[model samples]
Target: MKRRLEPGRLVIASHNKGKIPEIAALLGPYGMDIVSAGELDVPEPEETGTSFAANAELKARFSADLTGLPALADDSGLCVEALDGDPGIFSARWAGSGKDFGRAMELVERNLAAKGPEAGRDAHFVCALSLCWPDGHIVTVEGRVDGHLVWPPRGDKGFGYDPVFQPWHHDITFGEMDPDRKHAMSHRADAFRKLVAAVF
Candidate 1:
């Protein structure tokens, strides 16, 4: 049987401003006291893991061990079919040291264009969530959402590659879609649902 997350203080092991709020919002309904690793001055750990799940576990364990509390971490990325799943685990690194996603988005467009017209716009997002207790007990889950890429980008609402990626059956890009709507069907949400089912 999986260990349940008892309501109380939980550390969200991430420093990304955009990600922390999204995660906090998801955990809002649970009524747990949420704090971010950034808020606690927890240094970001090196993501040496080769896969999303491994990275998520690494971050969660790092924070949980240091803070002596339960920690949750999310490792997510965008995978382009034409790019051969490139920028997958390295999604954040694509943004460069300053974390400028606009530049990263442009790079993606440039790479895609270099492939010629026959190169498909097919793409997907992957999110892996890990929950860890201070004692090292952990639970992890992964989720994905399929979509295609677009040029010129879109709304400024979402961060990262949201502006250019439109999910299947949706006419608008994630950046253009309503936050609540995106949260309902996002790759992160999918992973959160699995996490909740397994541990909440």
Candidate 2:
């Protein structure tokens, strides 16, 4: 049986500023004191894992070992159908050294164009979350939200490829939606819901 996460201080094992806040907000209702790896000067471990679940577990284990606290980590990215998941794991690397997602999105657009319109722009966001204890116990869950790509990326409310992704049945891109709305329909939220059900 999986162990339940007790109400206490937990470390969020991530260094991304954009990701940290979203996680905090999601965990807010749990009444746990959440501190980020960035805030605690926890060094980011190399994402040597081939998949999101593997990476999430790697980070969670790393932080739990360091702080002796339960840790949560998520590894997420956009996967394109035509590109055959070209940037699946390398999504962040595609953003380049400056983490300029604008440039990253442009590259995606350019690459898509090369495939011709017939290739289609179907894509989806995937999030894998892992919760780990210092003793090596772990629970993991994954979630995905499918959508297609759009040109002239809209809105500035979100980071990464949010501006170009329009989720199924949604008229607007994730970037165009308010944070609350985005969170409700997001891959991270989907995974979070599962984690909450299992742990809390």
Candidate 3:
């Protein structure tokens, strides 16, 4: 069984500035008083989990426990098929402590090049969402968007590895798409749809 999210102040358990706004947009229609853990000065818990779901739940539960309010958290990253899903959970860590994603994208390209002509550039983005209550109840969902990797990373929009990922049918990378357009078919949006259907 799962608990419904009542319209009230809900904690968004994330310190990433990029993710907060995207999530806020998804939850906006629900009319909840959304608050971010960063805004609340809640410390980020160590992501000790090996998978996205575990990490999302960990963050959500931590915020819920601290604030005594329901919390929502998401863990997302890029997984390259050629890399055998390398940099899955460590996606952010690859950017270094300064969070320099530009260099990180370069690193990804270098790794692919090292694979020679046999490299399979197929890749996908994944997002896992978790909703947690102070009482320890939780609900979770996951989503993924498949695409192939492109060289010379295009566009200057979006964040992370968006510039290098071109979805299956789209000519432009995520970095080239408008925020609203990306939001409509993003992995985060897919997960949000599930979370909305199940919990809201």
* Each prediction's whole-model lDDT (CA): 0.95, 0.93, 0.92
* Model 2 RMSD in angstroms: 0.8
TM-score comparison, 1 vs 2, better candidate: 1
lDDT of 2 by residue, 102-141 (tens): 9999999999999997999999999999999999999999
RMSD per candidate (Å) reads 0.6, 0.8, 0.9
Query: Over the stretch 4-39, how does candidate 3's per-residue lDDT look in tens digits?
Result: 889999999998888888888889899889899998
Q: In terms of TM-score, which candidate is stronger, 1 or 3?
A: 1
Model 1: what TM-score?
Answer: 0.99
Clashing pairs in model 2? none
lDDT score at residue 182, model 2, on the 0-100 scale:
90
Model 2 TM-score?
Answer: 0.98
Q: What is the lDDT of residue 103 in candidate 1?
A: 93
User: 17 in model 2: Cα distance from truth in Å?
Assistant: 0.5
**Runs of candidate 2 exceeding 4 Å displacement:** none
Which is the winner by lDDT between candidate 1 and candidate 2?
1
Give every collision pair in model 3.
Answer: none
